[model samples]
Target: MNATAKQPISMNISALPGATTREMLADQPMRMTISKLNFWYGPKQTLFDVTLGFAANHITAMIGPSGCGKSTLLRTLNRMYEAVSNARLEGEIQLDGQSILTQDVTQLRRRVGMVFQRPNPFPKSIFDNVAYGPRINGHNQPLAEVVESSLRRAALWEEVKDQLHKSAYELSGGQQQRLCIARALAVEPEVLLLDEPCSALDPISTAKIEELLVQLKELCTIVTVTHNMQQAARVSDFTAFLLTGVMVEYNPTPQLFTTPSDPRTEAYITGRFG
Candidate 1:
């Protein structure tokens, strides 16, 4: 049985049209906020005390080298870590002012959807793949309409409109990735978490996905973990740098990439060290 969730609430994050600064953080309204977060895989800690705020209706990118705890931190936002045995976290992750740790897992999953590092489309028809999540969540909208809307939002409807009944695998790798995104969007999630969504796609596909992500923030908050600094700069409004399980710096994408306040952030961004 799905646990009962209160009516969906809206958040109020303070943000300027194009401003990204630490001093502005205090006034920013947030879609999700993390404070004093730590995570462990049994006795092995992967994240230290990390704190940050994700502005509502914005794309915040988490950039770091491999094993830097970026993925672990992203998973915690939706409580995805709970599925792993002995994986534990100590922290407060709030969605629209509600603590996600205390949220009903099913309801939270519905509101906060995820796209994996690789495109993992189901071995189903294109239409079926996009319709799956809405069906599982008992979305009231017409199923066909939901599928079309999701595909369009992912910027894939035009390419596959005539082949909705075809197998998802028959599409190119980029289409499969967009299909996965369409699947996630069908559920009408309020926040979307993406981890290296474009790492495997071609440059053209990567650009399309980046464009889609930028458009998506107008309707939902996005938190993505990417190793591509250029992608981060191209698509994100805010960027947070992580290092060895701790937050090195959190700033607007431009500030972090152009004039990082911390030397560690500069070193990593400049290729001095990973």
Candidate 2:
């Protein structure tokens, strides 16, 4: 977003011990990398020396107890914390080898889109909701095509195809959430951040969202914060467990869930304690 000239930042995840492993990343490139990130709200710190890498075209799940800074860490990727008074961050966050901190907030958000926990559709027509981002970003593509493509990707096009002109509020809870996802995708972001996206949905709705996420990995990288361990296991390729602002364990989802290296991770995942 910032038009200022700057140097590209190279991220060597392998050099940062415990940040990520070659086995965990496999052949996937790093889509976004956070190194030694620290954040605070005024004087109260929320995240401490957190380092992780989100693999390209993969779903990385952040799982932890309430107030453990899962959402706090996710917000840092797109610098969403800037809106909070007295919030501060210290670290380097790179998106495709570029520092997002130096980019314009508006443009950074466009490249790194987000969807909140609850379904938040606009007070406009279904078509208008999906078209909003592109229209604001001055996209040259035809609005109808973009809307259709986004909705299809979110897996809501067929159901809403006949109701494009209807108000978004008229849709079901799950449908509205998918619509929000469609709105985010309309901008064609490289990284999609979701904060407990399916937490408020029913089982069926949650399943749809999960399926959509898997399909979406082909288009963009996904980082999600979820309290549902089953959801994390079902959807994510990599999982990071956080406890009281510290990242306890980060590894491939299968390995982390089955044989976590850290005691805290095992305890939390096994329901011994949150």
> How many pairs of residues collide in each model?
4, 1
What's the C-alpha lDDT at position 271 in model 2? 97
**TM-scores of all models?**
0.91, 0.93
Cα lDDT tens digits, model 2, 1-274, are 1222111121354643453443556546889999888889998888877888999999999999999899999999999999898999999999999999999999999999999999999999999999999999999889999999999999999999998999999999999999999999999999999999998999999999999999999999999999999999999999988887878777889888987877778999999987
RMSD of each: 7.5, 6.5
Residue pair clashes in candidate 1: 12-29, 13-29, 14-28, 14-29
| Tens-digit per-residue lDDT, 166-274, candidate 1 | 9999999888999999999999899999989999999999998999999999879999999999999999988988877877778878888998877778889999887
Candidate 2 ranges with C-alpha deviation above 4 Å: 1-22
Native-referenced Cα lDDT, model 2: 0.90
Q: In candidate 1, what residue range of length 10 has the lowest lDDT sum?
A: 1-10
Worst 10 residues of 2 by lDDT: 1-10
Assess the local accuracy of residue 194 in candidate 2 as a C-alpha lDDT between 0 and 100: 100
